[model samples]
Target: MVRGVVRPHRVLSGSWGEVIASNLDYHRATFRWKCEGLSEAQLRRRAVPPSELTLLGLMRHLQGVERHWLQRTLAGTTPAFPPYKTYVTAAGDEWYDDSDPTPAREVYEDYVRACQESREVFARATADTARIVPNTEFGATDVRFVLEHVIEEYARHVGHADLLREAIDGSTGE
Candidate 1:
């Protein structure tokens, strides 16, 4: 488990691909920081009465996001170890379903591992690498586009994570 706030390497100077990767890594670290030192109850706490979002849920959702985009979309194959598959099978809204009794640690670990796998996927790719997102409206894309989209996804979710974390413990930071 991550012991404390992880200082992601600064992206002061790099190629376009390196910069994007660094930014994504920063967001991933921030997400982990937001969920750190929280109990299962706190991790599972919804922000509002009707909202299903929770720190744990976000972690699971992001896991699937990384796996789907990189492993499935980019690599054009299914993830060897599909994150939250069992929960998804049981409930269509597995990411938001708090009913599952899965441990918070497991969810966090899965997310971290998925992020690592995503890194591997990108390491084997170049900014200009041709890619076609199957079953999507867009016919074709490239590694750069996928990287940018993932960064945007993390940026949006990190905001949600900030709110959720604050509601859980009144803690806040980038």
Candidate 2:
């Protein structure tokens, strides 16, 4: 568990990479805070009827997102995490399927680890570093685009998490 207060990103001024990284780091910490101090059952509770969304699922999904974009697309290699490998082949809502029986601690730990690895990937990349995104209409793309896309993705999901967390236990904040 992260001790003490996790400081908010001071996005006043920095390089392009620093700005994007700070924003990404902020969102990542926000997501973690939203999920803190929840039991396994609480984490797995669905948001609404007929919806599979859960805090646990969101964490798992973000883990996959980090691995796919940072490890696979940017680094051009397979995901190092075995759970993610299983998720890629699992049928029917792989990320949200609570039937997998994996421990909530494992899921949360994977997310934290994946975020750290993603920071490393970004650290090695400059704004202009080019990486070929397979199956995209536009062949090669720059690191800036990937970083921006990650920020956008996390922003959207964190919004979802806010609602889900509030619905679960009435706790909410940025």
lDDT of 1 by residue, 1-174 (tens): 355968598587887768777888899999999988888898888975577788887888788778877777776656865334334544444344566677888888888899898888776654455554553635577666776777888989999999998887799887
Give the clashing residue pairs of candidate 2, or none. Answer: none
**Candidate 2: worst 10 consecutive residues by lDDT?**
84-93
lDDT of each: 0.76, 0.76
TM-scores of the models, in the order given: 0.84, 0.83
Residues 94-119 of candidate 2 have per-residue lDDT tens digits of 44466668888988888999988888
Best by TM-score: 1
lDDT of 2 at 32: 87
Error of 1 at 116 (Å): 1.1
